[model samples]
Target chain A: MPTAQGGTLYRGREGMWSWVAHRVTGFAIFFFLLVHVTDTALVRVSPEAYNAVIGTYQTPLMGLGEAGLVAAIVFHAFNGIRIILVDFLAKGPRYQRVMLWIVLGLFVVTMAGFLPRHLMNVFGGQ
Target chain B: MTNATHGTPAVAERVGTLDAPRSPYVRKKTTRGNYELYSWVFMRASGVVLVVLVFGHLFVNLMVGDGVEAIDFAFVGGKWTNPFWQVWDLLMLWLAMIHGTNGLRTIINDYAERDVTRGVLKGLLYLAFTIVVVLGTLVIFTFEPCPAGADPELLASFCTA
Candidate 1:
């Protein structure tokens, strides 16, 4: 009876964390897409309607949420590539830990590059 | 139903024989060649492309010029007017929809206990995915920034200006 939950909770490895993050981020993005499509479809209605809906997303609170969304997307996309490589390449699983570190490094670098400007846009008084 | 061995004697009999044959169902692996392999490959490929398409979309919409505030009806219209942006958006729409749908299908198959339930849920998911993708593609390609003979008041300012 070798079950996935047989082990203790906090004793998981990088692979476990990556799997968890992938599922979480995948669900997050899917839900966001639902709302995004609905709102964007408002464009077919009228300009004022579309703009008004999008205007609500410009709030400071939504700004933070947007940043979180970006982080989720960045991690998910990077980890996804790693998973893909691990599936296709024979040597991929061997260096998966190293790949995870690389993914994290890239995530941090890309976020650092984008987040500051995004934060400024959100909080900067137009 | 008469096979219900009730009471402590039944429990005692089952205790040391845990390794005995369990359910009547025989688990056999079906050989579905290459479909799953190709699907796995597609997930990675589409995912890689989606990263670029999604990030580029975000960068252009949220980072360029006035940032989030710059997004408006005319803003979208302005983008869709260009063939490059139209193609970009169309690809993003199709790829993301298909990718996300497949991911959800996987989730449903993993958790759904009954075959009927899985089938129903996946059918509904595919239906919604098809509608959204089709409508989205149509809108992207056929969108009229300003419809002819439309009321000027309801239209984007650019239309009248």
Candidate 2:
């Protein structure tokens, strides 16, 4: 809960929420990485084997999952840069709130550009 | 002024030398090296590189041409056949695995209140990290774009009949 030592500063603020999101997204990505590596490894088995597995990823359900995965990656990447700035920049702590907003803005723009094109590929009946 | 003048306090201050210790006990030297420090630095460093590598990967695999629909055995075969992509994937695999492992280690250290729980979680984490990295690495290096018996339709376009 908020009773923890470091929670005093981060509790009930953008700092705390962003930190939470980072951890959640990171855990998701790490597990996905394990599965991804295993799937890619199917290439060594045979072309048919690889395609058989990857074909599942092209389904509408998995397309939505891929979108979520990409969204997690985008947010994590931007917020990670924000964290580095907070750690290293002279004015980092002072501007961390503003930086979080910027991170969100970039996340929105990136996903906006990505989703339409990606959805088309997924559901465009090609 | 009176407290300063009062007692043995001023005497001890004057008598104590900077070069000598008041107690005979010696502090033990730290055997714990800067492993955590290096891990911290690696997360940040690898993070920056991963942003580039992962974005490029997604862009190529998902956002280009046919997008996710374009991905399959032939798609993967075509990309891995290129030395540039081979190196790219290899670096991404190792860096991402290590970075994620270290991050999870920090998380386990934070949340796993019990020593036994922490140790068990980290043991599994490292095991998974090793298997994935090894599997991914071998896949990238040993991938055959065109196997003799594979369906030609499944192989990359450039693969000769």
Candidate 3:
């Protein structure tokens, strides 16, 4: 029987949470890629078919979904770099908690820059 | 064998030593040599490149002048018509698919305990990967910016020129 208890160093903390987020986001992004490729392939069918499919992506609902997707990508990208550092740098494990904070900071900043422009484009009317 | 008449109870002949089992000892090497090691390295390497490729893609497509609203057949045709954008998208498609496929493979292995279950999930995953990669590559290579029968309104402006 596994208990909720975690040892002093790794579990029940930033390290575990980051890993969990990484997996969840990666799972979502993978499925999205499959669907995206399929949709894009509609171009080969005909211009009308392609436009009909892509038109849905411009809707407000899908725009919000895109924002969420971008958020996931940004976090995953920053955290991925952190993971590389952890793998290659000698001092990586020691400063992993700090690096996670840095990753989060970058996520916030990137999304801040992205969300407003995307939302305006989606809702601002052509 | 001791005789009962000698005051020692008869004992059946021992088939094997108590310390060792009857089955032959075969070492269980759980991993195929270096396959998983290479996968781990590939994930990291591809991840770095994907960060660059994917970020640039999003910035150009989503954060540029009109964002998602500007996307349509014309937008796509215009971009794919250029050799630079063609190569960029091709690389993005291949690298992203491979990276995502490998990530899903790791997830499937971690969660799916049964051999049959793991095999089935991975089979589907790889199948999807193959179809998407081949389709995307062909689309990039075969796309026509202007089809004679296509509605001019739907085609890129440059197509008419």
Candidate 4:
């Protein structure tokens, strides 16, 4: 039997870590979505107000923050798909570890494609 | 598997059987058939779609053309004018709200100790979720980036033209 201590500390297999990561990432995205919706809703108030709010996001600090958000989103999305397969497919739980590696591989590749472009847009000269 | 009496200790001594066994802990079984199963399935399906919708939104708003600087009222107005973007934004709004709300519902169920507390918290959560989603959907569909009656100075420059 698994001990509560081990489970709490995430001292289990890849599946456990994935579950924890999913929860963490889910919370992060949830909070961000709250703020994002409020800010986007500013558009309905006035053009100036909306632009001013979004303009704050153009700074170097926010650019870095955006990168972190993107990373959270990518990991959560990839892991979520893995979870779906495991829950739905007959052979999925048996090969979950293999699927995890595939998810990680996809995450890295997608991030590689996204990061350079995002960084260029943020840091590169006009 | 036998229908043992409530006061009988024999039920406790019995091993696993084909019949459903009682547990010390109270199990919150679902009354609705396959609802939870479908809900789990929906999370995955919506999540996959959200990945695409959200990434596309970020890519366009923060990376395309002049990038983040180009995003403003007029820019949004231009995009919303296109049926494609309108639908995209609509899907993103609905999917993300429902997905996030359901995830939080799960969290609340897991963590909340008291039934009343859990119900109250979930009630509030659902209320907030409904308000935001409904308002957002309305705004997306009814948005006029440049209202004719609005103050011209406050309106986007595109509106003045």
Candidate 5:
């Protein structure tokens, strides 16, 4: 009775929403992964090309980009972990809110810890 | 069969189906749930973030300066030698892994009907996730672009004497 529409979960309004996200992120990650693997293959492709690619990313803007990437990964990873737990291990609906909050908390904690270091290196002394 | 005038209400009726709920197969019926809503929000949020992350990566690596040709062990080695690249790489690794895994989780849930089957597949997913995340995080935080001693050919120029 605690859920959106009483205690029954499947009947709730959010099932489709979750389904959509899973699909979108799934493909998004796949595309990125495919490109990533190919690009990293540059290490084997030719050292010159690899070096070139590396040099470009050394920019401060790119550093900001990477920070966003870290945030994405954290959200996806932690949420995925939550889904897995819900589907298999816990199988308890009562704990979902708690899990969500925990995921959010961890994400904040990680960013707080990493961002300062990143900024310091980017803007601080040589 | 459930008749409007007679005996038992159909299974459909119980779950609010237009027809009477008759299926003995119907287990517990839930009137509603919120899990799906969160997922919807997550997709949009992740999508926006992914757009930035993915494009940022592409722009920097493919569009900037000397571009694709400049990437190499020494180039990469030099970059990773810096703390910034290490963090950048770390973020990319973590995001892709998590996003992909979550996406797959949805696929599994939607397709798998049997609880036991779902459990097994999800178990495999979790196992793989753990291995990848652990190995990846370790590699990023502890990456040694240039080791202490290695063949001159294999080592970056900076690594060699």
Candidate 6:
């Protein structure tokens, strides 16, 4: 018997999350890249001006902003890799889920390694 | 020729109840080669690696060296001057763009109803990928730490006048 909506619970094409994640990450990376380009472009203006631009980034707010940038790039790259695999290789649906979890686990691990170094530089004054 | 199937011999299988089980709504076909299995492995593997590579890139660029304050002409110039950072940035760029494009390709195939639409969308996607990846790679490799005959103060703090 069908559900209230009269459709099977999870009957549809393959790799739903992979598609969604790719789009979400793509937009996110685009936004981050725009900001990055604009900021980097400041260096071309003048030395002191570039210095001034860079100086503003030292604030805690900027650090937090960067934290987000890191996350966005990571998700986009990893999920994008997943989509690439699906399109070119034709992997299994069950295996895709397994790999996604692996990506998540690695994300956490890498963040653990990097965040400390960043926080040390930021808050600890290292 | 016969009325239907014209000279085609219709040989009914001798075995009874021999068909493989399948879901009612699901299409049944013999599974393809192990290539798909490998693709599954690549996604997870690349995904795991990307998380590290991409995040490391962001942290270094945006957060390191006096946080964002240290970032400037000198900042990027200094970073890219080192082959190590250059490689890092390059990896991040290549990986993310390819990944994103592949993801979008899947979406196009799943959503687009007509073959023509799918082909057009994929063509556009590939074009965009080419432009971004090429531009980004060039910037990373060819960037000059200092432009000739440029104002010093306007340049990065580290650049010699």
Clashing pairs in 1: none
**Cα deviation in Å at residue A104, candidate 6?**
8.7
Give all candidate RMSDs, comma-separated: 6.3, 7.0, 6.9, 5.7, 12.7, 8.5
True contacts kept of each: 0.51, 0.81, 0.84, 0.51, 0.21, 0.31
| lDDT of candidate 6 over B1-161, digit per residue (tens) | 25236654434332353556673565567578685566556555656676678657666664566554445566677787789988877886776666566656666776687899999988998887887677777777767777777665545556673
Comparing to the true complex, what docking class would candidate 2 get? medium
Measured against the native two-chain assembly using Cα atoms, what DockQ does each of the candidate structures obtain, in the order listed?
0.45, 0.66, 0.66, 0.43, 0.11, 0.21
lDDT tens per residue, model 5, B1-161: 64756865676566785445574565566677777778666655665565566556645653454443345576566777788777776776766666666767877887788999999988987776776667656655554566554335644677775
Model 3 ranges with Cα > 4 A deviation: A1-10, B1-31
Tens-place lDDT digits, model 4, residues A1-126: 223753554467897888878988998898788788878888788777888898888777898888889899989988888888898899999989999999999999988988888888778886
For model 3, residues A48-97, the per-residue Cα lDDT tens digits are 99999999999989999999999999999999999999999999999999
> For model 2, which pairs clash?
none
DockQ, candidate no. 1: 0.45
Between candidates 5 and 6, the one scoring higher on TM-score is 6
What's model 2's TM-score?
0.88
Work out the TM-score per prediction. 0.82, 0.88, 0.87, 0.81, 0.46, 0.57
Q: 2 or 3, which is superior by TM-score?
A: 2
CAPRI-style docking class of model 4 based on DockQ = acceptable
Whole-model alpha-carbon lDDT for candidate 6? 0.64
Q: Between candidates 2 and 4, name the one with more favorable lDDT.
A: 2
- lDDT over C-alpha atoms for residue B26 of model 1: 58
- In the range B3-110, model 4's lDDT, one tens digit per residue, is 465555575656544346564665667688897888888898899899889889978886688677577778878888779998999899889999999999898887
lDDT per residue (tens digit) for residues B105-141 in model 3: 9888877889999999999999999999999999999
* Candidate 5 or 4, higher lDDT: 4
TM of chain B, each:
0.74, 0.82, 0.80, 0.75, 0.66, 0.71
